[model samples]
Target: MNNYNHILAKSVENGATTLESHLESVADFAVVAARYAGMDTEVALQGALLHDIGKASVVFQKRLRSKPSPLELPFRHEIASLFFLKLVSPDLQPFMIDMIVAHHKSIYKDVSGTGIIDLENEYEEDILQFHLSDFSLWASEAIGILAELKFPGVTHETVITEEDAREAYYFALDHCRKRQKGWSQWKGLLMGADHIASAVGDFKEKVPALFADPDVSFYNRKGELYPLSLIDSDGTKKHTFVKAPTGAGKTDFLIKRCRGRIFYTLPFQASINAMYERILHDLGDHVEDIRLLHSISQLLIGEERITEKVIQDKFGASIKVLTPHQLASIAFGIRGYESVLFDLQGCDIILDEIHTYSDIMQAIVLKMIEVLNHVGCRIHVGTATIPSALEKEILEILGKEQVQYVQLSDEVLTLFNRHEIYKAEAFTDLLPVLQQAVEQEKKILIVCNRVANAQVIFEQIEELYPKTKKMLIHSRFKRGDRNRLEKELKNEYNVSPYACIVVATQVVEVSLDISFDLMITETAPIDALIQRFGRINRKRTAETIGKYKPIYIIAPPQKDPDCLPYNPKILRDSFKVLPDGGELLRETELQSLINQVYPKVEMLNIDLDAVFVDGKWRLKELWHLPKSALIEKLDIDSVVCITQEDDESGKYREADKEERILMEIPVRYSSLRWKRLKQLDIGAHPFVVPDIAYSSERGLDLAKTGAENYDTNYQIW
Candidate 1:
């Protein structure tokens, strides 16, 4: 009629994004992205306009409203979208199909098993019949919007029958199924556009902000302690590498070296969150100009939560803070890897404090550096104590001549002398030290190698000092609880004048700005020890200059299994290098110490497993690489589980996706050793763990979380 208002592509909580609006928004974004990628703008725009027309169908509308969909099971709107392929010009039809066919997923072997080719092979019946069910009516609706959009080859007079739609579907399918040797930039363009349109509703207002050039003048301010801020960032070299101690303004210096939009990555989520907040403050409250990306970014507390729910736009921010996991896809060539490459092309990517990563992570980083350089990305690496071997590997990847390297003089490094080192045989040996620190009303931090160890230490301290304020945190807590712990650690404990203690795992060993008076940590990798040591005596200012704090390292366990997540040899080497007898830690000697521990760099040869190898992408035809591409190659085979109360009380179902994520707890995949356990069919498909397995104070009870003792029937609705 007057308008095809019922046609929708994006379904929000209370309202729907109409097909016409979404198409227009996506086209606007696609055209701009094309300009950056140096591709044809018109072609990109046309592809975006036609990418979501299939959502105009009645079946998709019915599904959006939660009514029974008319089309057959495992319905794919992308396949249905291909029916209108005739609207595109024949010369450009192949590119247009590339934009639509696999924009949502692959044309073949999609994880959902609903890819066009997958459906064609799996169905006994003519699957086209179900897709074309009442296509005559929806085709009219689709045409109405296309005409309204003033799309080419379509007007009020244009008409397409169900048979015409069927012919177009087969043509598009045939074109996509044919193998090619290289990837399609057209698919990348459309995917980026559609993702932007669906995520940020105010597409018009936000389109101009993509790949923004932000103000780095604030970080360029001169200071006595912040020496990097005074160094000239302008140079012929495009890449940068800086080795500096904590509080030496490494973050500010890295930002100052950027030539374009920035993607800042840390090795951990907690550090990313802390950096996100710090950058926001440093940028003078330009909240719309930045973004935070990670699995748990939405779980950020208070103001971060409010801002996060409103701004779902992952790309186009002047700056983005994330972990390496989010960008690893490009190296592996996983699904949507093209979009990530498109976003990162010609941008400045900063890998902050990356010396702490393991060999597997370092290998990924090395490959990522090569790929990023190939795509014109300027890589800036900042770390305190990088081994010589690792540095050589990165320098080789980035081209030694192309990088502007900066490191502090031994004299300047001496200014950062802040910690007095002590060693203990075990955590039990630190009890007297902990008592003295508490008696002096000193803020104490205790870090362990494992979550169980942290929990055990937390209980021991709780029993020893009942009146002392204390908290424990690790990777295993429900997201909501973890958020509270981080908030308190940052705001309450860090700022509190009273003596308190916090026991944690490796989670806090990154760019978190929390400072404590004393630290007792289990022996770890040399680089990790440096980062943990930085957490003590961290309030580096002119007045606090030369002020020294104590850090006690507990000797590492001797057994193989007990030293898990770290090599026994590396741990032993690390503990041996630690200073005992109250020796001052010289920031000048860190590199030498690091190379001593990591004498041989063990690089993972991921060439056989990676999609991007040698000099090109291995896959062709835009098909998916399988979910296992990530899960198998990395330690991300972890799973989340929900509390029985949350699932049974209907809270889990009632909550939105972000809210439901807060109720779930993450655990190692190997932790679920039982065959049969009750599961929730939503949001990671988490298992229903018993109430006894979790608490708000202590995180997931590892010993009690085994599924062997639990019966499935107890959790059934």
Candidate 2:
């Protein structure tokens, strides 16, 4: 252990990180995490101690010390670590090997038949020569250090010969082929510990403890009657399912059920943002423990406030509000997934609004659930409405007896009955009704199925009522502008006592807390329609209870094929089950209506059998699949379409590449549209959209024509 201080693991401009210090720090962090996750602490410590043993190579040391390193290709330190596995007991070898080789990258990719193990002819000699150096001193120092640290099963020291290195390499390849099934908790712990130690520059900084006791005084202070508050908080320790109406204190109930760190997942970005703020407001003093994570989290956090602590909070927050898509990486074994698994182990996760997903996404979600279950996560799901078939499938995947199901009472549902259903033929037919509501000074909300339809409706409404306060929102607006508009909509329209109109897309369905006096929406699935209905008369006070607001459902598009975005059969069934004129659409009947519309789970023809083979999950093939494939399968794209005005701005020019990309809007773009934009000569910014095609008022004009006539260099200033 005394001699271990002489060897260096990393070199910076001022000083070096000694091998003994790095190893001890990593082992300390890994042991704590392993104990928390109920893993073998000794095995975790051994793996962490040997994780970077290869960095002691003379060639690697020279490269690290050079001012401007001449080495074109970096050495694989993980591969070098395998040379000394023989010093550990045989029983711990496989676990240690799995953690060593697969810690940084996928083992299947680096050690397969056609992978790095099959070195090219030109590099074969270099690699062989790299490993021929005498590493006996480093080996003896590491073994001595481990003995002092009291690490179990690592007392002996072995001279790493060339043959021993080759044997260990082959053994790792064979282990990856035959023994590796799912992600190893041992690997997750080691990777997590190493990352934290590297980032904090020391292992002494303890992992932040999770927020176990959240403040729920906000709900108690309101003195509001919500069925969820009546339930005991102790029930949250088990796997549970809850069925309750929207605005029925579902968020509070979900939080009360969490006994440790909370992962609250919603379906839409808009919803996640709303939930993040809601939790922050509710938690009050504990606000620092909550974080909002997504692809554009920096944008959501605003550019000026993004510090090192804010970035680190993504993986360490006690309460994380995000989309389930972020967790999909673990199921697919994408890069950096081990750290994610480490964060999720033994955490309490709340899956809110789970029914609003496609068939492919549902399958991926199921796979995630299975993995989370095995990792000791306590899963709690709460939804406004879910079909029986889908519920059955969820319970089967989770094991029926393992989860406790809870449903709200009919009396409480009756209290939430606030909408009166009415059917309309088209937006044209509802013009008179909207004009009348405008005259009565009532707040009106119009939801369209498509962005184009919303734009057209907004234009017509503006022309008809030239003096009314109106706004349009959808998925295509720039992130900054969209966030500003959402805040304005919530503050201005929600609190105003006068008449106003807002036209939007499905983005308004899930977590927005605004209320309207009247709602007009295009026909959608029954569950979705129920969510939409909740936006009207949402408070359900004594005065608003008997004064039921109207929700007009427009007929389906005639020429469109069975509702392009949603299933045609489900839409038709939803329309059939609608209450007649003057009939109250009671919230109690929503569950039955949803079941009627979707009697069976809609299983898409996506092959996921490869993910599960012989009743065991294997991530070998999934790890190799490109991330773009997963994004395409999810029917989402993180596109950054820069408007011509943005290209000329001093702020945009001064911003770094990542900051500029964060400013881009994340919306679904067709291949043809992306290709067309790519072909245009927009100077340095290849993603510039034509001036005539994008604006803050009307986002992303997909149907804009005569693009060749517009000035491509137009600037906002």
For all candidates, the clash counts are 0, 0
TM-score of each: 0.91, 0.83
Tens-digit lDDT string for candidate 1 (1-717) = 358766777676545788898898889888888887789888887888888888887778878878564454766788788888777778988888889888878777878777788888898247777777788888888888888888876888788887778888888777877858556778877888887777768535633357567776677787888777767885798899998999888988899898778899998878998898888788845534677886577765355345444443455668888888788877776788877887888899999877788777788888888889988899999997888888898888888899889988888889999999999888888888889989999999999998888888888888999999999988888888988899999999998788899999988999999999999999899998999888888987888888889999888887978998899999999889877888999888888889889887887787876766777877776776765343354665268888878877899988887888899888766777463557778778888787777888888887776565454647332
Q: Residue 84 deviation, candidate 2, in Å? A: 5.0
Q: Write the per-residue lDDT of candidate 2 for residues 1-717, one digit (tens) a residue.
A: 346665687787424778767888788778777776678887888888888877776656666777434454435677778877876788889888767875665544433322334442336556644554555544555456556556565554534566777777667656766654566666667777877666556314433443333444454433256777776655523787888987777877777766777889998877888887788777846545567776445555544334423334334467888888888876666666767877897788899878888777877777778778877888988898988888887787777676767788887788888888889888888888898999999999999888888999988988988898888998888777778788888889877788899999988989889888999999988888888887888875656655788899998766657387887877778888999685898877887778788878875533353344334666652133335365466667544666666665644566664556445655554622533443223223435566677778878766652235246453221
Runs in model 2 with CA error above 4 Å?
Answer: 1-32, 40-46, 53-75, 84-93, 110-178, 194-224, 233-237, 299-316, 605-615, 620-631, 648-653, 656-658, 669-674, 679-686, 704-717
Q: Which ten residues in a row have the lowest lDDT in candidate 1?
A: 304-313
Give Cα-based local distance difference scores for all models: 0.81, 0.71
RMSD of 2: 5.3
